[model samples]
Structures are given as C-alpha cells and as structure tokens.
Target: MPFVTVMAREAPVLVVVTWEKTVSASQTTTQKAIADEVNPGQWKVLKPRKGLQMIDFARLWQFRELLGMLALRDVKVRYKQTALGAAWAIIQPVTMMVVMSLFFGRFAKMNEQVGAVPYPIFLYAALLPWTFFASSVTASTNSMVVNSRMLTKIFFPRLIVPFAATGTPLVDYAMAFIVLLALMVWYSVSLSWQLLLLPALVALTIISAMGVGLILAAVTVRFRDFRYLVPFMIQVWFFITPVIYPNKMVPENWQWLIQLNPMCGIIEAFRASVLGTAINWSSLGMSTVVAVVGMAIGLLYFNQAQRKFADVI
Candidate 1:
C-alpha cells in the first residue's frame, strides 16, 4: 500500500504521496484521482464585449499584409473589365472640369474670382481632390456589402474593408493629378514652394473622407437605403464644397460658415498649394480639428458596431 500524507498550511493544503516498489494500475488511477481533486482543470468563459473598446492596432499591424492585398485587389477589380481602363480616371474629372469651366467660368464670369489662375486650372485642381474624395467615400460606403462573402467566411478587421476601398480612388487621383500638372504647364502657371503643402492637403482630404466613409459604411451595412442616398449626398456635398468656384467668391461674413465644411478648407488649401494663392491657416486649423474629431467618433461607432457585422452583414 502507498503512504499518503497531508500538510496543512495557513495559505494552502498540500498532499504528499510516496509509492514503494512497482505501483499497480489501480494505485496509478488513485494518484490521478487525487491530483484531479487537488488541481482541477481550468476553463475560460468568453462573453461578448460590452461598450467601445480600444482599437487593436497591434493586431492590425500583424495583418498588414492582408490589408495591402485587399487594397491591391480593389485597384485591380476597379479597372478590370472597363473599356476605358485606367483612363476613365483621367477622363471623369477632366470632362467635369470642361463643363464647369464652360458654365461656371465663361457663362457666370467666375474666372475673375480666381484672379491670375485660369478657370480651367482652378476648377481642375479642386476637381482632382473632389473626385478622389467622392469616389473614395462611395466605394467605402459600399465596401461592406460588396465584400459580404469575405465578411461571412473569414475574420479580419472590418475597418480594413473601407480603408482598402480608398486605394482604388487613390490610383484614380494619381492619374488625374498628372493631367493637372500638364494643365499647369499649359497655362504658364509656375510652381512655387507652396506646392510643398500638397501632401499635407491630400492627407487632410483623406482623413475627412475616411471620417465620413466610416460612418456611412457602418450605417449602410444595416440599412441599405444609404445605397441610394450616398450619391445624392455626394452631389450636394460637391456644391457646398468650393469645387466649382473659389472660396473667395463667398461673402466675407458667410465665409466662416463655408469654412465649417471640412472639404471646404481642404479644397481651398489644395488650390492654394497648387495655384500659389494665400493659404487660410485659420480655416485649415478648424478643418483639422473637425476631421480628427469626426474620425474619432466614426471609429468609435464603427468599432462598437463591428461586433454585430458577422451576423448583421
């Protein structure tokens, strides 16, 4: 028979056992039973997370390759079977610029509002960013539904879907931007140091678009009505933004109200960078604050809603 001893302590009780010679199968079973009674298996119960949680940026970084692949896939899918291929990117904004220049510039005499810069260059510069913003927002708004198969099949950050949607539009923006450079040269416009601010302005435009895109993407996933609403919203937004006309054309008193629109400041700053006009730092600062805050709120809502996406989507 095996000898068994027990040591009692204030903190915990310890069981000690000694075996003499070869132990029998029944004795081994008894030892295991003792061990099971003393130290039982542990289990972790998982419950749904409540409320907003911090974004797992480390996990996102771990899946950086997946994000890049998704973005590239979007770019490829955009121009895949299109007749115009990538040229459609250059054509859309350029066509809009021509029509706007004819109507708003020549007919309304808005060219004077732009001062030394020709109306074509001015309109195209604004259109470049506007077109990119509109395309990105629309694509992102539809990203969840468009990629529903992946959402149902696999697991990844839902944010990556909308974030990847921006990639296709960014490629479009680059194509259109080359045309803007050509237009600048054609109009005898000289590039200045202010052009260095282009990257910052582009970043601001992206932040604003993503802020709006995130909200719309989340809402659109549950309520499909936004599918029809987003285009009309983008159209209305284009008019409110200083895309067709210069920001200076607005009355001084009402200019502050115009500045309230995030895209207003971005478009104006973009024009200033490319056209060498005076940059409105005050308006830009307000826009920066709004963009950052909007992004935070959108992220919060999206994160909270993402838990339900696998089911809802």
Candidate 2:
C-alpha cells in the first residue's frame, strides 16, 4: 500500500493505493493456488471414454436432461417461422397419400391387392412410421455437421446429438398420427389385438432409424457427398418400402429381398395392425432381426468414428 495526494477541484485529497509488487510474485501466488489444488487426493484428469457395452453410455445418462433440452431447442427452431408450422407434417404424408390414392388406387386399381383395406387408409398407416423414420435419418445425417461447434466444445455423449434429432420428428409424427386415426375412422377400419403391437412396432422403427441415422451421422462428419446421396436413397427406399402399394404387391420371390430393408417389416406390420389384416410373422421377425443387427453395426461404427469427431470438426 502507498499513500498518495491529489488535488480535487483545488481541494487536497489523500488516498491509499494497493498494488502487486512483481509479476514474479503474482506467478508464485498462482503456482501456490494450483499446487494446493493439485494434491493426489484432490483432483484428477479424466480422459474421454466409451463404454464397452452397446447402449451403455454411463456418462450420457448423467446428461439426459441436456438431451431433452437439445431436442426441445431443435423442435422450436425447426418450424419457427413456417407458414403452416406443424401442419407441414400432416401435409407431407397426406399429400403423398392423396397422390398415391389417385394414381395407384383409383387409376391403377391397386387397392384390391391389400385385401379389403382402402388405399388411402392403407397408405397413411405406413406413412406414419416411414415419415418418422425418414425424417429422423435425414436429421441425423446432418446432426453432427450442424452441431460441429457444440461437438467440439462439449463433453457430452456423441450419440446424444443424433439421439436428440430423433425426438423432434416424433412431434411431427404425433401430429401426423392424428390424421391416420381420422382416416381409419373415415374408412370404417376396426381395431384389434394387433393394435397392441403398434407400440412395439414403433419402437422397432425408432431403433432402426436411430441405427441407420447413427451411421449416416458418423459418415456425414467426413463425407459431404451424403447430402445428395440421402435424397436419392430416400427416393429409392420409399419406392421399395410399400408406402404407396402394399408389400403384398411385391412378387413372393422378391419379398425376401425387400425384407432385407429393415423398414419393410415395420411398415407392413404397421399397416396390418392398423387395418386388422392377418399378421406376417416371418416378415416381422426378419425386420426385427435386421433392426437389431443394423443397430449393433451402427453403434459399433459410431463409437469408433466418434473418437475423431472433435479432431476433424
């Protein structure tokens, strides 16, 4: 401390000032503080880790609230200023159903193959799951890239980004699901025990979508070409997934190949349950197997890929 005198408007004022004496002393003080905190019992550095078991991200569990917040943020940002807002969800699937109803059901007489179920109702049922799956994949395909800054800066689970992307679409799916119910009632469709399986079927869709999305999310970090590939893939996937025409319309020999698409089982089962049609156990089982397999593979690769995300990002 030092005493100083100043003239304030011709009146003398006395003040005391305190100052750090030397940069060396300041450095010594900081070193002491750090040394005190660095005791073996006091602090330790934790390197990032991935769990050996799939779906066993313990650190991510600690941040579940963060996952919900990120999902909510995306939901708000997604339709913030849209003209129709969430109605866009209803519009996309409903429009596709109408176009298919006109061109295939009415013009081409495709409804007869699905056996007693109306084409519009048939189409909308499958649309619910497909739309959910497709949009989830699309979001995941870009999730890592879009949140590159957060990925680089944050310590949360890498899976949470793609996992969070899956949530916003469910809001859209729920909105679209209401339309499906109206169509079911309009078409005089009846519910049955099969409807009980709807939740299980939806779970499969989420798992499958997340599985595929994880792969795409990991890849999108490295390959920019996926943007174009995604649209083309979605087009091809839609045509093959029995969205417009019933899976029954596909030749019997080709059914096995189509079953290779994990969605084949989910959408078909979804349609059958919604329309009270006879269940196809083989297709459903194949799809379940593929979904689990796809999930395991995606998790394997994603875990390996995530190690480099922050570095490349």
Candidate 3:
C-alpha cells in the first residue's frame, strides 16, 4: 500500500509491504516506488524555500454561484417595500437631471457653453455614470458591517460581500441607460459607430468604481470614519468630476491636470461614447492608466488588510 501526504511546504510518499520475507526490491526501489505512487513525476523533490501563501483564486472561482445569490439578495432587498420599487432608479437620475439643468443650465446660464446638445440630455449622460459610482461606493463601503452575521457564520471570501453590493448599482445603471436611450431618441440625436465604445467605457467605469470601493470597504471596516466620509467625499467628487459641465470648459492647460483625475476621463468617455461626440483620447488614456493603477493599489491594500478584518471588525 502507498499514499501521499501533502503539506504546506511539500508532498511526501510512504509505503508498506505486507510480506518482508518476499521483499523483492531494495529500500531504494521501495522509496522510488512510493515516490512514483505519490506523483507520476518527481514526488521526492524538496523545495528549500518556504511555502507560498495560497491566494485561493480557485476557491473564489468555485463560489461564483454564491456571489450571484448574494448580489441578487442585495437587489431584492434594496427596493423591497418601496412605493415605486425599481422605478426609483429611473426617477432619481431623471430628477437630478431636471434640477441640475434648471440650476446649472438655466439659472447659471451654463447652458450656452454646453454646445449643440440640449442641457438636460448632457447632464443626464454624466449623471448616469456618477450615480452608479456613488451608489456602488456607498453600498460597498458598508457591506462588511451590514453583513456581520454572514461574515461570522459563513466561510466565504469577505471580498464577495463588497463585490455583491457593487453589483446592484450596475443593474440600476442599465435601467438608467435605457432612459438615456429614450432621451436620445426624443432629442433626435443620431447614433454613430462611436456609440459602440459604450461597453468599454462602462467596463472602465465599473473597474474604477470597484477599485475605489475596494479601498473604502477595507478601510471603513477598520476606521469607521470612512462611513461618514463616503457621502461627503462623493459630494465634492461630483462637483470636481465635470458632471454638470463639459470638460471643454476646463481650459487647455488645466485639461492635463483634470485628465489625471480618473473620473474626469470616465465621465468624458461616457458622454463621448454614448452621445457620439468627439472622443477625448488623451484624457481617456490617462484615465485608463489611473484606473488600472488605482485597481492595483486597491487590490493589494484590500488583500493585505483582509486578514486583519475578522480581528478588527
């Protein structure tokens, strides 16, 4: 009989022979046979280095079904007893567009600078992505705290909680995007091939939002100050993100600085991609780099902090 035992550092093989008198092979042959039984190749090999920390990517992959269930749970629970139900998604963005168009577009006379597009549609285009980002950040930041019972009870990836929370906003974004489509039709705005860039733009938008959400979710669990800061930061963030104004008004010299703000590019990309306007390639490229860098940092920080969450939270 032969068997293999796998440890954090290595795998070793063992064998037992029933009849010692009939030992047909030397100890070397027995060891080799055991090694071959353990692994078809080299089972007796040793590694001088310490074992690596297994990230368990496959475990996360196996839990994809759980992830979907959790995301569905969030969406169902969000609008459970609300009067309008999911209509709130459409209502909120549309309402904001009207108010902003009136205040910034009419009252402030910024409408003149908004170019050929009607102010309402322009503002709606920007709001769509901003709203998604804001909602995702808020939900993700509080995900761990809200699911403490599950965190303590279940043996799943903690990151799944924040990832699931972020998913509901994506559904809201899709509903809002439909509204945007209707508005485009109402305005008689013609769609061009440029509109095809939306999927990529939307992908970038989610990555950027999730990157920020990941950082916030981890930090908020420890400091708790981030819970309050999320809304306040989003308020300031919206103003700086050119949600109500064109990046064209940002000045040529300052455009470089503005492009460095990841959302600046994301918003500009969304508007250009959906509205069939000129693509701001420089800004979009800058934003892509910024978003990717932020994601890397966020992932590293979140993974590093994940181990401490159970102890701290």
Candidate 4:
C-alpha cells in the first residue's frame, strides 16, 4: 500500500512530513490517491493527528500548581496593606448581622419568623454561603481581566482563571467558619453529623459561582459593561435572597418559587446543616438542577468565547 502524509498548518507552513511509498502496485493504487484517502483517517504515514483539543481538562489538571499559585496570589492581594487582613471577612458579615439583628430581628419582629432558631444564629448560618457566593462571583468575574497577561502568553486551561479566583473566598470561608463554630458553641447549638456535608455545600456554591463567573468573564472581555454590572447584580441579589430573614417568612405555597433562585437552596442547606433546621428537599432538588444547568450553559459559552478572548482583550 502507498504511504500517506497529512499536514496541519495554522500559519506559515513548512512541510511537516515527507514519506516514501515502498509497497507494490497490487497492494495499493497511486501514492497521491492513497494519500488522499488515508491522510485524514487511518494508515497515515506521519504521526496520528492529535487534532485541536476540546476542553483540555487534562491541561486544567496539569495546571493545578498554577491554580494554587493564583489562589494564593488572590489572598495576598486582597489583604495586602490592609490593617485588618482576613478579619475583614468577619467584619462585613458581623456588621450585616448587627444591622439585621436591629432592623429585622428587633424592629420588624422576625425572631420567631422562621422557627425556634435564634435570629442571629439563623442569619449567620445563611451568611456563610452568601458571603462565599458573593465574594467568589465578584472575584471570578474579574479573573480574566486580572490574568490577561497570562491568558495571552500561556497555554493553560482558561477556566482555571475563574476557578482559581474563587479560592480566596474559600479561605475566608474557613476562617469565618471558625467564628461560626464559636457562635454555635455560644448559642448552645449542637453540631450534627450532617455538618460533614459542608464540603458538598461548598462544592455546589463553587460550581454555581463558576457558572456565573465564566459567563461574565467571557462577556467582560468584549463588552466591558460587565465590570459595572457585577456589583449592581450582587447588591440586588443580596436583597432578593433571604440572608437576613428566613425563607419561611415567605408563604408556604410560594416557597418553591423562592427556591427557584439557586442560592436559596444553598443558603437553606447551609442553615439546615449547621443550625439543624428543617431541610426543604424540593428546594434543594430544584437548586441542584438549576446549578447544573447553569454550569453546562456557562461552560459551553465560555469555551466558545475563549477562542476570541485573546483577540478581543
């Protein structure tokens, strides 16, 4: 059979291969004819086509060291020259707790709104997930711009930018969780076996954040309008979520409607897992579905948009 060669050219081309046909005439037709048939498929004389890669998850996996470095970089840059450092994480949520404790818990009289749970602890439980979500979303949205140099110069999985950006919040999450532990102790709440599910809860929040972040990162590279929209969206999202009050405050019949917001389920799950509140299975199920759908859509768009980021940015 005649040998075949296939050339892959992205730009100015040099002959990547040259091959000689040694087989007899009865074994195959003319070399050119065989090359046409075999070059793109099996029996290629040159090495097999690796082809353009898709997703490059192995590339992402190989870039774990880079991801860790970026994550650490985020944490350092966040607290650098700031007197409070990591304390700021607790400060924001604690202040929010105080405001809600005064307005919602005291004046609005929502102490018994949810259940027998104390208002402060109830609010704090919800705060943990919300804080992580908000911080992660903001950071991930800006990740591409922040790492523009690397994106243009290197060949790592672009998804790592947003994924790595989320790590700082996860660090803050751990520290704030310490405070949560103390609060649980102070409030005399017992830890349940379900608290072990914290990792899973965090995974869901991260996935959800990445889903939103990838979409925003892609758009931000082109529109630049997304930079402004992020903060506004966070503020609006805060009010819409039951961070200060309980979802139970909403009518029972409409509970499913409220859970349509994916964060609602995450927040509810965090509260239930930590504070031993009742779990809303339906809300949890719905939120999981929404998050998964959002992630799939985000990945698809991010992959599509990634090709143009270097060009646009």
Q: What TM-score do all the candidates reach, one by one? A: 0.84, 0.82, 0.83, 0.81
| Model 4 lDDT per residue over 1-313, tens place | 6544344222112221211222233246555566775332223233432434245354465567998998988888888999988899788878887888888888988886867788888888888899899988988888899889988897777888888999999998888888889889999999898798789889999888888988998899888789999999998998778888777677888876787788998888889999875677788888889888898888878877887788888
Whose TM-score is higher: candidate 2's or candidate 4's? 2
Candidate 3: residue pairs that collide: none
Error of 1 at 64 (Å): 1.3
Model 2, 53-114: lDDT tens digits are: 33424446657898899899999888889998888878988888898788988888887776
Ranking by TM-score: 1, 3, 2, 4
Which regions of candidate 4 are displaced past 4 Å?
A: 1-53
lDDT of each: 0.82, 0.80, 0.79, 0.79
lDDT of each residue in 84-176, candidate 1, tens digit only: 899988888888899989999999999988777799998998999898899889999999999999999998778888988898888899999
User: Which stretches of candidate 2 lie above 4 Å from their native place?
Assistant: 1-56
Q: Please list the residue runs of candidate 1 whose C-alpha ends up more than 4 Å from where it truly belongs after superposition.
A: 1-45
- Cα deviation at 41, candidate 2, in Å, is 5.2
**Top TM-score prediction, candidate number:** 1
Q: For residues 159-251, what per-residue lDDT tens digits would candidate 3 score against the true structure?
A: 788888877998999999999999999998888798888888778887787789889999988889999999999999888899999888887
The global Cα lDDT (0 to 1) of model 2 is: 0.80
Judged by TM-score relative to the true structure, which candidate is superior, 1 or 3?
Answer: 1
List, in order, the clash count of every candidate structure: 0, 0, 0, 0
